[model samples]
Target: MVGDAHRAPETAAGRLGRRLLTGWAVLGFVYLFIPIAVIVGYSFNDPAGKFNIIWRRFTFDNWAHAFERGPLTEAMVRSLQIAGIAAIAATVLGGLVALALARYRFRGGALIEILLVLPLTTPEIVLGASLLSLFIDLDQQRGFWTIVIAHVLFCTSFVALTIKARIRGFDWTLEDAAMDLGAPPWRTFSRVTLPLIMPGILAAALLSFALSIDDFIITFFNAGTTETFPLRIFGASRNEISPQINVLATVVLLASVALLLAGVAARARVEGRPVVVLTDTDG
Candidate 1:
């Protein structure tokens, strides 16, 4: 009965409209996935000349030697490290900020909300320029830690907003009840508040990691003499575009998808919701 459509005798016009909407949805999905399809397809292709775009022959060599390029591999590893650290740092800080905003009335709460929105609305170029200037004023070297710090700066807003949306209208009475049952504050939080909010936190962490890994502009401005995966790809493109890029990208794409799906399944299990939302009705 959940998500059931209002079924009735349909006219030809109604049928035509439904068909049009379904076709439009299909078209949108195709448009979004076609580039990803091309990327996955190209990973198997051997370059005809300097171009990996040409489909000359298929081979497994690119997948086999995905980490063959030293600079690319190092850059990718660095990017992963930075993303992981930034994600954890952002998630913890953002979770606390979101909890504070959601759970308590405090001074400057509205101002804090506005400030959180500013980073998301601000242009990447402006953020990068401002951060670069700040770093120069502090005389801090732009490297791994700087990149991680910059990522955390931009990513915190995303994490906070995401978790805030998730925890909106959440029942805090459960936490209070647990505390009333003689649980310590830490225990109540770890057992009740944490489990309730963990899904949102995980989602935010994954999102922050993805954004940090994919970021080019902020990383580019802040990364002095260091190359992230995106930076490496851009640099390599100036020389030659390799199939290995596509291969590694496909791996990342699949891994991210897998993680998301796993999280969804786990959450569904924890919440006792249906694993699959869509259902078929029989006449």
Candidate 2:
């Protein structure tokens, strides 16, 4: 009876702690998502003026005419084109770099690694300015190609690092095993190695795409006459803040969310078996 009495207070304290932690978690989520909530909520808002900040009423008019603005739609399409091209280029180049670094121990490996990190560590302003100067020196026009090249330059680092992190301590002997089983090197890589690392590659590609699409400073420096979605929004903010902007942004948010869900589902399906890797780092 006495022991039970003593344990009762400890149980109550534990419950109290759990409740506090749950409250804190709820508050943290609210803090993080409140702005997102506001954006979504305001997408449906019917404002009296050009600015959609102050909500007057709710209407589906915004959704009905979401893509009616030709300039805005064109800018969005431009951004998508850049993002697609940049993401593909970055993913291919970075995937090769990641594969080489993970598999081989060649000369100048340390230097290559350092170079990979430099773009990531450098400030966006500095990189953008450097790119601008390079283009000027080459007498190249600052337009779609320049923006794509600039995005690829910075996004490659992110893609490489993300894939490297994903494949760190990964077992490359699996390749040897497949080769020993009479599989050609290319076939072994395509059939066995590719499947395992595909998730990481997809993740890196998505990251690259997101970065390329959302880039402002670099694109700002490189874009001479071309206007991306972000640039269009900036222009709109100066003149008229349209509800269409919010509508498009919300659409992007939803697409991103859908992609995230699909990736998660694919990962779950692929990860049924445990990934075997070597943890030893000794040479």
Candidate 3:
């Protein structure tokens, strides 16, 4: 009886702690979702207002305008093109660097790692100003390619970090076994290491693509006459807060959500769990 009485308080404490955690989680979710919900709601507002929510009515005119007449569509395409190139370039370079870092312990390894991550840690404004100055000095034209190069600089760090983390936790014995069995270094890497780290590489690429697409400050400085999506949005704000802006914002939000879901799905697949999509289909 005494033991049971003593255990009851501990059980109650555990329940209380769980409840507290659940409450905090819900609060955090609300904080994140509220702004997104507001933006989405504002996108559909018929008689556009400063606030996203309207007590008036709903319309699709803004979305139509954004897709058809506004600069939003062109900016979206440009952003996609730049992001695609940046993602591929960053992933290739960063993946190679990560592989080298993981496979070997060279002199100044720590310094190289620090240099790789320095861009990520530096202020965006500072990086943008420095890059702008460099371009001016080199007499390089400021346009789509400049933006792509700027994006690649920072995006590479993200890719390297992601791939390196995966490589760190990887089993090196399998790779050594492959080499020992008369496989070439390239073949061992392709057959063994590549397959193991492919998911991380994919995740890194997706993340880099998203970051490149959504970037503003660096792109703004590098992009002279060529307007990227974020630059267009910022330009538009100077004139008026059009409902078309809301539509573009909604598209960006949706894309971000989709990419996030994809990353989660990929991570789950990497961990060898049955993906949610397949489970839902089976059900």
Candidate 4:
């Protein structure tokens, strides 16, 4: 009777702790997503004033005329182009670094890895200022190429780290097997290694693209007179906040969500696993 009484109280306390933790987790998610929900909700709102802050009514006009904002559209296109180029460059360089680090025991390996991670750990504002200063010292023009360089500098570290993580536990015997089957080095790499690592590379590319597109502080210092989408939006907010901004933002959000779902599906398929849907399965 005494043991039973003690166990009952302990069990109750554990359940209470779990419930509290669950509640906190739910609250955290809600807090994080509230601003995003607001952005999505206001995308459909039609405001009368220059500022799109006040909700006037619901309208589809913003969606229909999303790209009608000439400067905004141009800026978005410019940002996309820059992001694409930067992602490609960063992925190539970073993938090489990751491969080298993962496959080899080289001198200064730890130092190199630390150097790669330093950019990620450093403050973006400091990176931006430093890059700006470097360009100034070098007499380099702070424009498209400079923006690309700065983006690649930051993104390379992330890509290298992500790909390295994915490839860490990889089996090298597969590559050896391919070579043993009379395949040349390049052939073995292409047929065996590349396919296995492609998912990580793709993930890194997508991440780099997203980061490049969303980057503001670094671009701000290095962009010179060139206005990317983020810069344009920041400038526009001061003078005239457009509903088109919200529309574009909503579109990007939807696209990102779609991509995330696609990635999840792809991963599930690759792992030969069924996706677990959350629902009431009980009768």
Candidate 5:
């Protein structure tokens, strides 16, 4: 009875600690989200030839202007194109690297993994400068293609990491079983392994796309004449903060949020959860 009495206070203390942690976590989330919320809110403000939020009224004219024929729209299209290509290329390369890492044990495997992840750990400015130097040395044009290549360089690491995590948790027995059933290695991989890891691949693709689309510094270094959406935004902020830019920002923000939610929903569905009804309310 004395021991139980002593344990009660300890348990209560643990619960209290957890509650405090939860509260702090909630506050942290709010801190992160509030700024984004404010930005989105301000994106709808009307342009009175001024960038100040206090002097503006709410309007959708900025969004219309952003979408209309302009340099901003052109830059946005260029950005999307570059990002799409980069995401696809990075995902493919990363998938292959993840497969090799997961399935093979060779000499200097650890070294190879480290090398693959080097771009991610290295400072972006250094990497960007190095890429620019290489392009210059090779006498290559610094344009959309260069930006795409730069994006792929870092985005591939994220893809590999995501797919590798998924691959680690996978059952190799399924692959072996497929092989035993007289399926060829390629067939087994395509039918068995690919299906199992599709969710990870999709997640990696989304992550890569987001990274490529949002990248500024590296793209800035590599992009000579070809300007991306973020690059345009940066330039615009220097001259004059246009309401049109806010519209573009809001659109991108909404798209990112929607894509993120969709990815989560897809993952849940793939994992055999009913996304429509998350919990049972019955006692």
Candidate 6:
């Protein structure tokens, strides 16, 4: 009877703890999603006031006239252009670095790896301030190019690290075999090696693009006359908040999600598997 009584209490305690944990998990997700939900919900709001924070009424006008905000649209276009250019530059440079580090062992390899990692570990504000100072010292004007440079500087490190991780376990023997089969280096790389590593490259490119687009601090320091979408939104929020901001933000979020899904689908198609392979053999 004593043992049964003790067991009953222990079972009750376990259930109570589990219920508490489940409640906390639910709350955590709600906390994380509440702001996003607000943003998405406000996109359809037809607000009488300039600020769209308050719920007025639901309308599809904002969605229909998404580009009605002149400066906002222009800024969004500029941000996209900058992100594309910066991501391409960063990916090209970083991919080369990743290939070298993954495929070759040489002097200064450890030092190079450490240097590559240093930028990632460094605080963003410090990096932004240093870059600002460097531009001043070099007599370079802060503008579109400056923002692009700043983006590439930070994005390159991430691209390198991600691609390196992706290709670390790659088999060089395949490349050797292709070469032995009378395929020139470029041909072999394009046909065999490139196809194999394309997924990693694409992932890194996407990451770099997203970072460049979302970057605030570095862009803020470097963007003198140039205005990006985020910068425009920040400026507008102080004076007048528009539902168009929410519309654009929601559109961007949707676009990003679509791209991510497309990437997953493409990877699945290419690999003939539901999930991507991290190593040679699937377990």
Reference-based TM-score, model 2: 0.88
Candidate number with greatest lDDT:
4
lDDT of 1 by residue, 1-283 (tens): 6645766778999999999999999999999999999999999999987668789998999998987858888899999999999999999999899999998878999999999999999999899999999999999999888899899998999999999999988888877777677779987777777767888898899999999999999999999989999999888787788898899999989998898789889877878953221131232
For model 3, the superposed segments whose C-alpha errors exceed 4 Å read 1-21, 48-55, 64-66, 266-270, 273-283
What is the C-alpha lDDT profile of model 5 across 1-283, one tens digit per residue? 4667556455788989999999999999999988777777777876566563444677766656668888988998988898899999999999999988887777887887888789888999999999999999999999978898899989899998889988885667777877787779987777777877888898899889889988999998999988899998887776777767667777888888898888778776767954222122332
Instruction: Using lDDT as the measure, name the better of candidate 4 and candidate 6.
Output: 4
TM-score of each: 0.89, 0.88, 0.83, 0.90, 0.86, 0.89
Q: What's the lDDT for all of these models?
A: 0.88, 0.89, 0.83, 0.90, 0.82, 0.89
Model 4 pairs whose backbones collide: none
What root-mean-square deviation over C-alphas does model 3 reach? 5.7
Q: Which residue pairs does candidate 3 place in steric collision?
A: none
What is the per-residue lDDT of model 6 for residues 188-246, given as tens digits with 9 covering 90 to 100?
A: 77777887888899999999999999998888888987899889888788888988899
Q: What is the lDDT of residue 246 in candidate 2?
A: 84
- Which pairs of residues collide in candidate 1? none
Full ranking by TM-score: 4, 6, 1, 2, 5, 3
* Better TM-score candidate (1, 4): 4
Candidate 2, residue 173: Cα displacement in angstroms equals 1.7
For residue 104, model 1's alpha carbon misses the true position, in angstroms, by: 0.9
Q: For candidate 4, write residues 167-189 as lDDT tens digits.
A: 99788877787778777998777
User: In each prediction, how many residue pairs overlap at the backbone (N, C-alpha, C within less than 3 A)?
Assistant: 0, 0, 0, 0, 0, 0
lDDT of 4 at 102: 91
